[model samples]
Structures are given as C-alpha cells and as structure tokens.
Target: MDTHPLFIIIDDVHPILITELEKSGITCHYHPQITRNELLTIIHQYTGLVVRSKTPIDRELIDAASNLKIIGRYGAGMENIDTDYAESKGIVCLNAPEGNRNAVAEHTIGLLFALLNKICIANHQIKNGIWDRNNNWGQEITGKTIGIIGYGNTGSTFAKKLQGFDVTLLAYDKYKSGFGNEFVRETDMETIFAEADILSLHIPLTTETNNLVNRNFIEQFQKPFILLNTSRGQIVNTSDLVAAI
Candidate 1:
C-alpha cells in the first residue's frame, strides 16, 4: 500500500506552503495552468488538493476525484468549490483566511484612505496638468462612522487596523454574537444603515450573498456613504452599485 500522501496544487501559491508540504514527505505537484479536462484525467491520483480562484471544483470534478481526502484553498474565498457535495462525500474542504487577513485589512484601509482623500482623482488631474485644490477638497477620516458587515477574520483585522484612527466602528454579523471589542461596537443592520458614513463588506460569496447589495439596499442608507467591497464581485450587483454612486 502507498502510504505517501499526494497533493496537487492547480493554482499559484506562496512558495513557503509548497516547501512545507514537500518537507512533510508529501509529493507535491504544482500545475498552475492545468486545464479542466486535464485535471479530470489526473484527479484520481492525489489524496489532497490545493487551489485558488483559477479552478472551479464542481460536482463533475469532485466526482472524478476518487482518492481526494481534502481540498485546501489558498485564500479566504471558497465559492469556486462545491463544498457541500465534497463534504457529503467525506472530503474535508478548508481555507486559510487568517494567512491573508492582515494584508486584506491593510489594503482595504489604503483604498478607503485614497478615496476619502481624493487621491486618485487628484493624481489623474495632476497628470493632465490640472491643479484645483479648493475644488477637490477631500473628506477627513477622523470622526467618521465606519460600519463593517461580516465581522470575520478580514473584518476584525480591519477594525484592529482602525484602532489608531479617531473613528466610530460598528460591526454586524448575523451568524455571530458578542464579537465586539475595544475597537468595534456590535450593532444591528438598521443602526449601521442609519449612522454609518462608510460601509465595508467582508462577507463570503454564498447563495444568501449573491446580489446582496442592490438599489434597495443602497437606498436604505440614511446618508450617501462611501461603499467598499473587498469581497466577491458577485456580492454586489455592478449596475446597482454604479447607480448608487
């Protein structure tokens, strides 16, 4: 009997993870550009799988993975995998949200800062040899209310990053309770809608989240808010988001 575990990575991942797996005596195969049909043909050989957003592990692919014991997603999102069906077949699916939470939090803060300061607009204007400072006065982040939807790894990391800033933080997660800390106040959606000057989404893509943000959702906000969505693109209807702006 072959006791060595075989793991196939169908997407690009950090070298450290692959190195660590190799050190553990697991045979690792890195195939960043593996096609769907190619993957189906070679699926039965691996005991474990590593993936990112490049491949969709649908029911057909899962059915072909006869020896697949586990599937590891490099980042937070696992919408590409058929988790329910995989689990039903006793295949454990996992994700590394904690690994990139800080990076996501920092990048989100940077984007929010750039938007609030009119940095992008100013940069474009400057590049075109136009400088009108008074007309492009930017908003200050201090004293602003930031409402975070989905107080998970990324959300909590963002709240922690905002601790130094003089801003009010509110977090709401339907699946959670008592998640509030010194940096965030646990609140309901209605309160967030009424008081948030900015809203940030950090939820995963699921059946309940498909087109979660729409025209009606935007209209409920008491004031026009700077919306930030670092989650899946499908979570917000692009047309509705454009109209909201």
Candidate 2:
C-alpha cells in the first residue's frame, strides 16, 4: 500500500475517519492547537491537510506546503482556504457538508421556534420568578411566508423540515435554478422581500455573499420580518443587523 501523510488541524471528527485513513496507509497527525506560523513551518512535510476553519490556508501557507496535494475541510464552506489559488496549484479542496446538513437544518428550525415562542426569554424570566405571560405572547408559525436565501443543502433541508407547518416557502439561490420542490417555491428576490414574514439565511461566505444582508438589503423588505441565520456569521453584517433590529 502507498503511504500518504495527513495533518489534522482543529477538528473533533470521529475516530473512524482516522482509522480508515490509517487502514489505507495514510499517516494521520491530530494537532488541534497548531498555530498558523507552526503550520507554515511544517506543512511541507504532509501530502494532505485536514482542517475545520481555525487556520486560513492563504497563498503564503499554500506556497509553504510544497508537498500538499489535498485540503480536506471537516465541514462545509471553503472560504477559510484559498480554493482558487490552491486549485490553480493542482490541490484538490474537499468538504463534507452532508455530514452535518441535517443537524444544521434541524437546528435552524429549533432556533426559529425559540425566537417566535420567546423560549429563551421566557426560560430566563421564569427562572428569575417573573411570570409575565402577557409580554411573552408568541407568534404562530402557520400561514407565515418564509423566504430562504441560498437554497442549497441546509436551505432545502429547512424547507423539508417545514413540510407540515403550513407556511409558504420561498427559496432564492442566485447560482441555482430548477431546484424547487413541493415544499419550496423558487422565486425572485423581489417576491421574497415583498411577501415574506420570516427570512432565513443559509448562504456561504464569499466575496459576493459577504455582508450580503446589510442595511439596504434589510430595508428592501416591505414589512418587518423575523431574521434567522444558520450560516456563516460574516454573511450578515452585525452592525447593520443591530441597526435594523
């Protein structure tokens, strides 16, 4: 069997992966606390690099990785890795979003429900002995218009989770077409902004999507809507969101 060296950085991935890699003659090293400078100093020794967003594999790091043939990201999103540059250098960039897509989708719904029902707020108040039911009146999920931006794995899974909710689902993916199903209505941004009562973001962080949800984007909505983000934090400008809220 051919031997391949792999360096693991900042991932709590299951042990099975390491076992499988070793079975395939791949040397695995788990180093969760490796700094960027240390990675640059020793990256050239490995053929594969496994990371989970703690270190940015920039051009300088890539240049330092003389033997790197592949970059395996533990989860979705390759923004932390300079994919274009790596690809230009013939390095294969890989990620496993399917591993946790369901978890993310389900968590998104959990958060949405929590916000609508004021679960966190109520829990805090109840624990403090303030029984204020009137101030905690909740909103209903049924019959609400939900606009989902970026209808990819998490987005479609979220729509699936809303199957029995009786809410109108609107999905807009700028880079996708013909992906809508019975649970989701493929629509334009204008329609989503004009009609949605709830907005959920599931887009990745990229040059085009960074700070995509800004003041102007929020103001485009015809009515005030509850915002839910289960994607990269950078996608929504925090200051802009604060102002909008």
Candidate 3:
C-alpha cells in the first residue's frame, strides 16, 4: 500500500502554506497546467488538491476525485469551485482572498483617481507635446453619489477608503441588511439607479449573476454613470457598458 500522503497540486502556492503542508508530512506533485480532462484520470489517487481559477471544479470533477478530501483555492472568488457538489460529497473547499484583497483595493483606487483626474490622458498628451491646459479638464469625486453594488469585504473597504473624499456613498446588497454607516447610505437598487454618478461593481458572479447588468439594468439610470468593474468581468455587460460609456 502507498502510505505517502499524496497531493495532486496545481501551481506554486504560498511558501508558508507549502511549508505547513510539508510539516504535516505530505508528498506533493506539482502540475502547473493540469487540464480538467487530465485531472479526472488521476484524481482518485489524490487526497488534497490545490487549484486557482484555470478550470471549473464541477460535479464531474468531484465524482472523479473519490479520494479527494479537501480542495484549496490559491486566489479569491470560488466561482470556479463547485461548492454545492463538493459539500454534498463531504469535501472541504477553501480559498485565500486575504492575500490579494489589498492589491485589488489599491489598484481600484489608483484606477479611480486616474479615470476621475484624466491622469492617463494628460500623461499621454504631454508625452506627445500637446499640453493644452485649458482644453484638459478633470472632475472631482466630491459630492458625487457613488453607488456600490456589493458591500462585502472589498466593497466596504473601498467605501471606507473613499470616505475622506467627501463623496456621497450608497451601498446596496439584497442579501445583507444594516450595512449603513455615517459615511455610507444603505439603500435599495432604485435609489442607487437614480442617484449614483459613478457605479462600482463588487459583486461575485453566481447562478443569479450570470448577466446581472443588461439593457434594462442600465436603462434604470437617468445619468451617464462611470462604471468600474475590478471584480468580475461578466458581472458587467461588456457590450452594453461599451455602448453606454
């Protein structure tokens, strides 16, 4: 009998996590680009499996992993992992969103500032020797009603970060209640649709969120809204967003 604790790995995970796993006395196999079809063939031999967002961990994959006890996700968003099927099969699913949240938040803020200040255009135009200061104008975020679609970890952090700017913040999440604060106003979708100058999407993609933003969704707004989507790409309708902006 093979007594070694075998882990069917994905890519390189955090050294700390790897050290801890090795400390527990487990032998690991690294497969940086293991396809779903390939995983199915050898999954029955593995007890622990680690993956990122390369492939979907659906019911078929779960059934293939008869000996799989735990699945570890390297990054944020477990939309790639089929939690329902995994849970039904008594397999634990976990992810590391904490490692990447700060980076995502910082990038979002940087992009917001650049988009709001026209910094990218300024830099590009100045490099081309066309510095017309009067023609180049920028808008301030102050007093602008900014609507946040989801008030989870990232959304709440962004709202708190933007509070010093004095921008009116509105947050709406149907599943949650009482996320309001002195800096943020908790409201419904209707109020957000009518009031927000810039709308930021921080919602997770799921069965209900395959195409959350569409023609009817945008038509609710009476203003030309600046939409920021640093979360999930599919949450915002790419074609409709392009046309609206």
TM-score of every candidate: 0.97, 0.95, 0.90
Go through the candidates in order and give each one's C-alpha lDDT. Answer: 0.94, 0.90, 0.84
For model 1, residues 1-245, the per-residue Cα lDDT tens digits are 76889999998888999999989998899998899999999999999999999889999999999999999999889999999999999999999988889999999999999999999999999999999899789899999999999999999999999999999999999999998878799999999999999999999999999999998898999998998899998999999989777
Relative to the true structure, candidate 1 reaches a TM of 0.97
Instruction: Put down candidate 2 lDDT per residue, 199-226, tens digits, no spaces.
Output: 9998889999999999999999999999
- 62-180, model 3: which lDDT tens digit per residue? 99999998998988789999998898999999887667666776778888888888899999999999887876688888889999988887888888888789899999997898989
TM-score of 3: 0.90
Candidate 1 vs candidate 2: the lDDT winner is 1
RMSD of each: 1.1, 1.6, 2.1
TM-score, ranked from best to worst:
1, 2, 3
Candidate 3 residue spans exceeding 4 A from truth: 1-5, 24-26
Query: Highest lDDT, which number?
Result: 1
